[model samples]
Target: MLDVRASLGECPVWCSNDQSLYWVDISAPSLNRFDPATAINTAWKMPESIGSFTLRKAGGFVAALRSGFWLIDRDGRLERKLIDAPYDSTHHRFNDGRADAQGRFWAGSMNEKRDANTARLYRLDPNLKLSAMIDDIMISNGLAFSPDGRILYHADTPSRTVHAYDFDETAGTLSNRRIFIRFEAENDRPDGAAVDREGCYWSALYRGGKVVRISPGGTLVGEYELPAQCPTMCAFGGPDLRTLFVTSARQMRDPEELARLPQSGGIFAMRVETPGLPEPRFAG
Candidate 1:
């Protein structure tokens, strides 16, 4: 684990071009990068809560902040807003998101109060157009696409259910939404996730403190426990792409738990046999 930590660490992305790891601290509202070679850590403050982000094919990054999707330059500058947030920021904010293999940016909203079904999943096209993909979400997390781009997986954290949809890659449309896997316990709520080259899903079980590798057919294949009380997300990094890095949460956790797990907010890594697919760049 890296010595650095965050209150709410999530949305880990491996920039193979740079051979570094990029992630965000939702509570800290900052973007951070870690380079293993030099053991260096860097961060840039965000104006608002950043739920998630993706690298643009051309340059810089596209991020889903509380305000909306915006372009971020290398020097940590906001170039411009692609579009205003679809929902009211007073009660909601962007959460987990990523770019599909086709370069479509997909981000889902999170309901702050967890009372109403006001959340929705959004897709930003290459032309900068925005559209809704799904709705009635309590907490949107675990957004991932299959290796072939023919399947889409998402989850509602509070619902403890991870769902899969038949994806029309050509049109970027979804159909046949079905329960991919439903957690039977409250602590096993699914959070952020990523897919491997073998077309399998690996999800970070939030309070359950473990990452689960599920088959394409939604069968549990493997489970790896963590030292933290909450594992927020996981992504593949390193040159060989065999290292699985996981982010965790230290914010809002009990004091006793924090003391027991001093590395709660720190990033942890492990080696895996199956490699992960490269993070897709935003086409827009």
Candidate 2:
């Protein structure tokens, strides 16, 4: 575990080139890099809350911050604004996201109020054009692509539903949306997720204190219990990509609960039998 104790840790992206993990603490409004070899972590403060980010092929990162899409350098400096916030920043902010295999960055927004469905998903092309894709979402969270890059999986946390879409990699479009998985537990909401080499979807269950692996057909295959109650996201890392890294949250927890789970916001890891695909970098 990399025990930085973040307020709300999310988006754990592995950098195979450096063998380090890049992640964000949304509530802390910072970007962080963790070196497992030395147990050292470095952080870059952001001007505002940053939801998610993907490494750019050209260098640095393309981030989804409170204001909108922005290009951030390796040192966390905001280099350029890619687009303005399409939704009202006061009520919504970009949340979970990543770059597809074709190099297009896709991100989804969340309604902070949790009382309305005003959030939407967006796609940023390599040419720098931004387009809205899905709408009427409440808490956009899980975002991952199949190993073959032919299917996209997404989840609406508040609704406890994960959806699959037929992806047209060449055109960067989604169609034939259908339910991939649905949680029946009232408190178990699907959060951030990742797909393994075998096409199994691994999802972090927020408030459920566990991570679940579901086959491509939507059957639950395995479960990994976590000490933290609010695990926000998971990523595949390590030299062999067999290490599953999970990020959690400490914000808005009861004092008693925080006392029980001292590493509530720390990053956790476990070895897995299957490896994960390398994260795709933004072509832009």
Candidate 3:
């Protein structure tokens, strides 16, 4: 059985080199690191909301803030600003993001009120230049890349579909968009995802209390149920890459719902049969 604890955790990532699992508590403005071997957890607080983050090449992390991306140290130190993604017409904020195989950082934006198509997907290159990868999205959320780096998966919350794109590894471009999977009727919405070595995608359902395994062809293969309803994102970690770490949210639940699901905002864990790919590094 998987045992872990986190409140309002949003981005769950695995650091293979360190054999540690790192994630963020968005509403609480904190970052947590769990060492499975020591069975100990460490946390650091930040002054602002953090949408997502990833391991850096040298050390530390690249974090997404409400207005831009910044380099941060392990002690919650602000190294420097990298990119700015401010929306004028909407109260949109950065949500989920990850790095591609080439190290380019990609993330999506979403409206705080869940209204309008102001959210967008952005790509930041090593040169520190930012550009729109996709635009006019309702609520840009999770992201994933295929094993061969030929396919990219994205989700727009309102549409409730994870869309796939034909990706060009050399050019860093996307085309041929199509629906990858449609969530089951009662499964809230698809939030975040991670792709495995076999090209299967594991996605977290926002209000369903489950992490689903969907094949490359968009077929449902399995489901890992959780005690929380707002599972946000998931990533595989460990020496053998068999451990699955998940993040959850507590923003939208009511009192009655919270009473029944006290673990609603905590980070969760499980062991999966298949191992996952190393999280791609951000080129910038």
Number of colliding residue pairs in each model: 0, 0, 4
- The residue-level lDDT of candidate 2 at 103 comes to 94
TM-scores for all candidates: the values are 0.98, 0.99, 0.94
Model 2 lDDT tens row, 171-269: 988899999999999979999999999999999999999999999999999999998999999999999999999999999999999999989999999
* Tens-digit lDDT track of model 3 for 1-284: 12343446777788877788888887778777878788777878877778888877767888887868898886668889886665752477788998888888887888877667878898877788888989879778769999999999999977788999999987889999999998756666989889888999998988888899999889999988888888999998888888888888777688898788777777677888889988877656
**Ten-residue segment with the worst summed lDDT in candidate 2?**
127-136
Candidate 2 TM-score to native: 0.99
Q: What is the lDDT of candidate 2?
A: 0.94
* Model 2 stretches astray by more than 4 angstroms: none
RMSD (Å) per prediction: 0.8, 0.7, 1.9
What local distance difference test score does each model get?
0.92, 0.94, 0.82
lDDT of 1 by residue, 1-284 (tens): 78565899999999998998999999898988888888787999998999999999988899999999999997668899989999989999999999987898999999998899889999999898999999989889999999888899999999999999999999999999999999898799899999988988999999998999999988999999998979999998888888999999988899899888888988999999989988999988
Pick by TM-score: 1 or 3, better one: 1
Clashing pairs in 3: 6-266, 8-265, 103-282, 103-283
